[model samples]
Target chain A: MTVEKTKTRLNIGADPREFQKRPSWTNEDILALLDEEDGTLDPRIYTDEDLYRLEQERVFGRAWILLGHETHVPKPGDFLTTYMGEDPVILVRQKDKSLRVFLNQCPHRGMRICRTDGGNAKSFTCSYHGWAYDLGGNLINVPYESEAFCSDFNKSEWGPTHARVETYKGLVFANWDKNAPTLLEYLSDATYYMDHMLDRTPAGTEVIGGMQKWVIPCNWKFAAEQFCSDMYHAGTVSHLSGIEAGLPEGMELSDTKIPTVGYQFRAKWGGHGTGFYVGEPGMMLAIMGPKVTEYWTDSEAANRAEKHLGSAERARQLMVQHMTVFPTCSFLPGINTVRTWQPRGPHETEIWAFTVVDADAPEEVKEEYRRQTLRTFSAGGVFEQDDGENWVEIQSVLRGHQARKRRFNIQMGKGRSGVGNKDFPGSIGYVYNEEAARGLYRQWIRMMTEPSWETLGP
Target chain B: MIDEKMRAATRQGDISLEALSLQHEVEQFYYREALLLDRHEFNDWFDLLDEDIRYFMPIRTNRTRREQKKLEYTKDNEFAHFDDDLTMMRGRQRKLMSDVGWSENPASRTRHIVGNVLIEEELSASELSVVSSFIVYRNRLERQVDIFAGERLDVLRRAENELGFKIAKRTIHIDQSTILSNNLSLFF
Candidate 1:
């Protein structure tokens, strides 16, 4: 292969020769360096469009992307407008008691049909014109269907195309690919971790409040990478010590534990466990607030946690802080918040957050849920608001020409990986290993090089 | 002549109280409650509320005329405003006193004004249900702040000494739909 730079494309300085030579993007080729004892990540992964578009097609298009929670659309005609892999989507409850996902764009002029965040709509008429469709995405009326066109204009053919919709527990997922894996299968080992939350309740969890949406100025990766045992940033880019005032009465927490959990498990396939930061429940119960502390001690809290969580004396300790579902979502069980970093441009992403509570919980319990969510994840949240600013500033500096020349480090506990250990799930160091980030970018390299997913599976 | 008339006159409402009587008493009771809050005397405020007091502020949501969706986005299970107990109120106050509580540090100055008192009815022998319109002006460093006006439906009962009607409960009805400012830190 001729080795050189491409002028039109941003030559992110990763050995460009590899892209010219490789025909198929296989897991093995990228996994090749992933297991290398002394390998480094190229910083180009932050900005390369070729790799970005591929990820949109392969990862997001193929993976079970979380559209919106079921609570957002409880009744028939309830609709929420969201995006499924860059395709504008409308998640609505159908007359058949099933959920439907459809392209929000009009079939005629391709204008977006629904512009609002959420509402109960019997039918959506295109804002540009009057092309109307129902919850089922069947074209019922067009302003000029009869007069402007011949009977040859088939309204049936022009109806919005619906995407594949499925659910794991209560989470709704949309797949652009018709032949994608089942939602449960796509979840894999991630299910094992999720069962602790979903199985805890006999009726399953219900989203109490609707979703909270916020935007951050960073690549989607920055938000995704935050779940990968990145506690090194705890004391720097965000607040680890600043918010720790005193707790209520009968509370005690020295600055000993980490705020988020730290665990990384390899999927039966290639998916990994969300590594949580390690904070103790004693601290959370005390500092989070009084109403919250009472809910944690309540019997339902334990009865639910026990069904899915294995019998461990300390399982309900609230120690597993950041229980992330890697690649995109981060579900913090302690605070009961669901947030997604949906990538907008290469440098910007929307941080959509939702607060969850038990559907059957008492009013006091729900009130506590609201308080904890607001204190931790609201617009003026103690933790999130601070980190978002840093993400914005970091991307600003990285995208600058002067800052682009340097390569940053991902090598945490070097030479500590590759050799397997008992406590950790992956073939890396301990549970709080940097191997997840290593694994993520390695997968990135594989996708960038390979053609379509002709080389997937074990 | 006014003092002589007050000693013998009945209240504007019917069915006069058989208990203590003093014109200056009710005004002082309100003034004292405002003083306790303005002074950040949360302990005194806690003492003022009856043990069985019901405190609530339902969330307000914009609903179409046909549908009556409960202001609760959280399925009508939780309170949108303060629904607190004695212990919880004390805990909140403790947090405010803490050194690290940034929102309360150099605290936003506040002044409570009460007027247009309407004695609705004598709820009980000792308890009086009343409504008063009030305006509280609040300002911090960065932003100009003001709470225009609201009516407070209050149940006032004679304190242990029976000197006057002490506020047993207060429910404020704010006219503004939106809480444009951040947190609801102080009492209305």
Candidate 2:
């Protein structure tokens, strides 16, 4: 393939690209903080502003981030507004039935072109000025163009910057870097586990509800890391109270013991990770009531799902799993609370989450899933409250000078983690281990230091 | 059976002298509940609900004016911001009381403003449908203040006595499509 540098697209004074490259931290300083072999990390990685700025460029910029579900914009002219990293983006369904993701800022003055969260529109017109663009984000009109500007001014050259859009099993993803690997290649072996949520039924999945958005006073990585590798938190430190409270009436806490049989999968190359219990649905029973659990495990629905999924174990036994697709996207499989942790500076995160269910599932089953997620994972969710509290408290402590002086101990089952499991793929480990956490920071630092995908790959 | 009765009652909009009297009584009940919430009497507030109550808040969507007319909220059971039975509500209260429910540990101060009280209908001698508007302003710590405005559709049931009443069912419809607050830990 031949490559060519396109000319400057818009006439917004001194290029915004130059202004965005103003971070004052060096790669050496950041790399020194993350000791990959020893599984230790400096707290400064969570508290520094310059490091945060560099992360926006190195990590979020190159990664393939999830936009929304395909069913969210199923028809032509449908659109939804979301953020890729901190940049507000508009995901639109074009006339040809393909997807387009573009920066929401107008080229004329850098104001948002589409203001509302989402809608169907023939074209988007800037509310600040009268500049208009088609669903493809191609510039079509500028109010009073003949009288206000020179004849040499061209409308075709002033469209919003578009990202490379792709999909896997109905989930939409986009990347800003053209050189980055395809979404399939970037996903690597993580797809096997993602199928537990996205591809269980032949009819596929559809987003069940509107987005639930809320802000938390904590860094984005804290949330991402927890989802990727922290199933150990479920047994202690957090969620035990929630689990005990959610237990059935006739059963006592002593009768229901937390399951210890599970495996954690850290991706071979990318920072993706997932963990799930093997033969126990105890956590699922506590979080999602007996009705939903029965439907997910023993009902005819489970039979059909196992047939379509080609694994009885995955359909019936893989209960209450959590996963993260690196930099931002995170979700729980049985609970099905999918979210994007949009970073807002270093100390805050805006969580935009939604729920999905099999399109072919019974209405009652779908309703049960919805209700269960509302009680267990949303902003007011019981388990969600526990997880957010720890992150918020840790962030508050990171503001202290003494807190950043020591390195966090992430050495749980470090070298003892086995190579692979016969049933599961990727590098496997016991349920309670920090191997995935080490893999995450190792990938993070590599992305920050290396300039291209060729050097960053396994 | 209660779900069906509550659903039908909330859909009716009949007004009568007896209905207006019932409306007055229900309005007073709401005002008292608001005062209790503002004062942080959560345990006492818990007693105002029936043992089998269904408290729900459906997730709202931001559609164009035309699309808004189609359906402003998600389906009754499809997605809800808060869907609590009596047991779940009790659990929430228990968590808040414990020192671990950090969302409410440094508990937020809230003032629930209830207005536009309307007795939609009198479903039966023992059951009445009531609708009202509310704006809850919550302050946490020093610099955080969030205002949530919404409407409540409730089924108020008369207890054995003439003066006692309980909320059998409630459906809260938040105004903003996207909730701006950090969490919906505070009740409306």
Candidate 3:
């Protein structure tokens, strides 16, 4: 296949970093709110506007945010428009099979550079003012340039701000900070756990069923933290009813026991974390349906994955993994529902999500992956509704003054270290604990307060 | 195998009904189904489905007008909002009826405004292919209201001596790329 390369050339160009006025909150205020010692959290962290603004600048600005799967824009000149902390960005596949991510706003009047969600485009012309830009977001056309402006109105200088783009196993991520750690360095030890989803097969993964997006009234952190560490919710009533409904014919909820043997890996840096059962696939069975469960755990696919992933036991373990690659990227390994929690405001998050399946899997297996994800994890999914309800209700409650003033206890498994569990890397804890949540908040605080990657580096 | 043949024939609009009187019967059947849903009489609504029904609503993705040739949904047997056969549909009904289905504990008051019924074809003496458009207005509690508009292609089979029909298959094509509703907890 001939990849359609971009007509406009890409240079590192000028770095895109924001210089905002001093905010009302200080580093001390944020630190005091999150007491890492006792694991107490102020509710304002989910409700405060000033802190949210700081987060967009200090956290999302520097962090490597997962944009979309590379398959979404595999052909050159194919672009997917999405958001990075409320700033619209376009991820385009350039000629030479490289990717370019840039702000989607026009330099002329700040309208969107690409109006559609995803498509193959030679150039994107702003509908508002008719300003056209090449695939690399370089301003290539100005309507009636000779009649409208002087010779100094240089097209080369008016392009949209470009972000540093990187791809790890077909996942495209973009970062605005020029000095931040590379994507791999930022991923740290999280890659080992992430590989459970992306690197399970030699052909790797490709996106299926397109994007499923919806809005929820909740802080993005709530969704991120839950995916990072909250296995506690899974065992609760949040999923029990859905799991019960998905049980095999003639089998009751009491027919099987929910697995308790699982481990949560809190990242050493970057707030990335993952948790999964070692030898249980009950959740996988419930969410992904029977066809998918067989394909995922049966001999043929499992053996191939074991060889490629290089962990024979883990590959064949029938494990159901839940993971977050920091800030917003979260995915369920067996279910394969990958989503980004895009922060709309302090109290609203727009969930943009898609599912990925093994590229070389049988057509039927791929179809099952797509079908199962929609039925179990998409915007209208059974499990997704259970999760969203909790977040929405919590956000609604935080509207009260007293609710905003109370402290949320996060002291599950505090001081618990991975002393005995040598099987997994990083700080490990029981599945139903807040060890990863603490790690996430700790990293969030550090990122918000520290000015440079030098100070934030592990 | 016959369902595929029937669907292909229906899409081809190969109308074989000599008498168009059955069109009124099919329209009334759909209206009754809508009424059952609007009244939240789920078990009664469930009875309208054939035991081997394949009811589905596929997720539609956004595409430009120029890219209209590309399908909005995934390939056959791929992802969908619902891919329910009889047992799975029963499971959904059971969840909605349960007391702890949090998303629907206080069920959203729904109106499945099924209209534009067109009896497109006669697949067999017993089966008729029908097309219809619907606008479902759902309101939860005192606030959140979501409206979903879509078109449904259904395969209806003649039931016993009654003029009513049973829906053997329904493919609901929702118009919105991103569903504005929180959950598709209700049947379309």
DockQ of 1: 0.07
Give lDDT for model 2. Answer: 0.82
CAPRI quality of model 1: incorrect
Model 3 agreement with the true structure over A1-458: per-residue lDDT tens digits: 11112222343333233124354877776777787786787878899898999999999998889899999888999888898999999999887788999999998888887877887889999898888988877898889998988978888999999999998898999999999889999999889888888998878999884677788879999999999988888876787767766777777767766788888888888899888877777777887777887877785888899888777656767367888888999998888889899999999898888889988988888877876677678666767877877788899889986566567888888887574576676788888888888888889899989898788986
- DockQ value of candidate 3: 0.46
Task: Report the number of the highest-TM-score candidate.
Answer: 3
Candidate 1 lDDT over B38-113, as tens digits, reads 7777667667777655444433333333333532132334323444545445555554555544445556677778
Residue-level error in angstroms, candidate 2, position B29: 1.7
Ranking by lDDT: 2, 3, 1
User: What does candidate 2's lDDT look like per residue over A204-263, in tens digits?
Assistant: 999885788878888998988888888999866488667755766556556876888988
How close to the true structure is residue A51 of candidate 2, measured as C-alpha lDDT? 84
Q: Quick one: best lDDT, which candidate? A: 2
DockQ of the candidate models in sequence: 0.07, 0.46, 0.46
Please tell me how candidate 3 rates in CAPRI terms: acceptable
lDDT of 2 at A328: 86
The segments of candidate 1 whose C-alpha lies over 4 angstroms from its true place after superposition are A1-39, A48-55, A235-237, A241-246, A249-262, A268-271, A277-279, A290-300, A313-318, A413-431, B1-188
